[model samples]
Target: MSARSKKINNMAYGKLCLLLLILSGLSLTIHAKLSSNFYSSTCPNALTIVKQEIAKAIKIEARIGASLLRLHFHGCFVNGCDGSLLLDDTSTLLGEKTANANNNSVRGFEVVDNIKANLEKACPGVVSCADILAIAARDAVVYYGGPFWKVKLGRRDSLTANRSAANVFIPQPSFNLSNLTSSFATVCYKLYVVLGLCGHTVGFARCTSFRPHIYNDTNIDSAFAKSLQNTCPRSGNDNVLQPLDYQTRFRFDDKYYQNLLVKKGLLHSDQQLYNGNKADSLAKKYAMKQGDFFKDFAKSMIRMGNIKPLTGNNGQIRTNCRKPN
Candidate 1:
């Protein structure tokens, strides 16, 4: 090429390099908001303390592990991971506890309260309830024999909770495949959403939530559906519960995907994952590969935890997890 052409190409390459540098810098700035060692200086033992408490809780009630994980999801899905779900309704602040999706459903507030008390004693106002939820989630997953991942901390508690937002954002058990896909896609991609749903591998659903699927749905296995129907009656006793994955309800494995393959998923939303849709292929892949399921679930959880977080000087660290400081 001529000197002039060479000079033009060189200029274009320099511009491209500068653009790449700028993009890289932006990415770092965003990532710096939440660091794995965010509490290294302020509360070095934050994770250790949280894990200790979680171990105690899990020992007493193994299902608490799933409940704690659900708490993190409930908090993160609405207005970001700002600990809004933990807030109790005050005279002026309406919390998420009474939200349609959360009322009488979400549990493990006492576990969070216990963790926050210990954290306050250790680091006073340094650790945020939001961060505690994030850490506790990882600890809960690991405690239940799930894959472990380092939680990115530094999130702050929200000053106010939005019950309306919680009702609107939290996915319902009755959602169809399209609705479920759209709900999770709001936070990340469809694949990550499916991985996140793998959390169901460890938990149970109340009869009220799964009654329709067990009694009315035609997709579920007849024998499995009949068994659940015995537990969850037709008329009343909505509080009765059944495992989401009856095969391995207490273990964090890919049996949830296996359950879906045979139409044994206890929730309509879950069965939708393998109902011959876009997510069906992926569900089959996870069911066949437990290792892949665990790996993707951990990665997807980390992504979900990184949703819109309140970091830096925004929000506050609540001394009481149920109330703002």
Candidate 2:
């Protein structure tokens, strides 16, 4: 009931308000760091532009959806999802397209270019190519009957590409279980490695990449291998292509895991997941549950998209995704 008591109570209340303000600011900073609505204000139509471009491309060639998804994975796997894979070779910069894992193997560059061009027109210099790729990947999955997830955005394009790192980091088809596990572990957890392999459920592999498996690998089914060998010769015609999943190549289902169960997985790297290792149980579990595969695939993709993103002035918004500006 005195002036001294009233002053002390007022001081405590002011201190509590200050503390709450600081905590609220920190929470917002973290949330805005990487968010699905990153372009809601800056480029309100960014997601729509990306989805429209992806749908057009998939309509032209359904396989393109898988290629676009693979592009995101390859880019994120090496130096995070910075659109480094989209870069073209230059006098000073040697890009990842020339890497052994990517040379003549990675497809759908034109599709990304199409999306970038449209986005630039809609909201010039607003949406980064890295964010476009991430959103395009989610759209691609939905176009192909796969489960959808909200892609975290605000990633900026990297100023440099790592050609050597791509070769060393990206998993190769010839890789066995040990090599495959180590390759994916470099960028993501062992569990994600399995989910990443599940992406194969929608794509096809070139005959050049799978010939040895169909002809020499003992784990593959005899009839299935013979079927592939009919098109993929032992000696020549390396450019021929075969669906990665014999059952449903275009559908983003768990048939890839089912093929692994039957020793019919098209690639040596794919079968290795079920080759009596820690991943074998996961392979079996996914093989029996399509819903589980869809759920985990969506979760792993969001995690993969979050890897080492360049945001908050860390990198530039590239006008041409292939070159830094």
Please count the clashing residue pairs in each candidate, in the order shown. 0, 0
Runs of candidate 2 exceeding 4 Å displacement:
1-32, 189-192
Model 2 TM-score? 0.88
lDDT of 2 by residue, 1-325 (tens): 7998865755544434324322331111122368889899999998988888899999999899999888988888888888999999999999999899899889898888888898888889988889988998899989889899988888988999999999998888888865654455434334334455788988889888998788888988999999888888888878887888878989888888998998989988888878776567778878998887787778767767777888887778999998988
**Candidate 1: segments with Cα more than 4 A from true spot:** 1-32, 189-192
Q: What is the C-alpha lDDT of each candidate?
A: 0.80, 0.80
lDDT of 1 at 109: 93
Candidate 1 accuracy as lDDT: 0.80
Model 1 residue 265 distance off true place after TM-score fit, in angstroms: 0.2
Give per-residue CA lDDT, model 1, range 7-104, as digits (tens): 67655544443243223311211333678988999998998999999999988997998998889888888888889999988899989998988888
Candidate 1 TM-score, C-alpha based:
0.89
Positional deviation of residue 152's Cα in model 2 after best superposition, in angstroms: 0.4
Cα misplacement distance, residue 264 of candidate 2 (Å): 0.7
Q: Candidate 2 — which pairs collide?
A: none
Pick the lDDT winner: 2
Evaluate model 2: give its lDDT.
Answer: 0.80
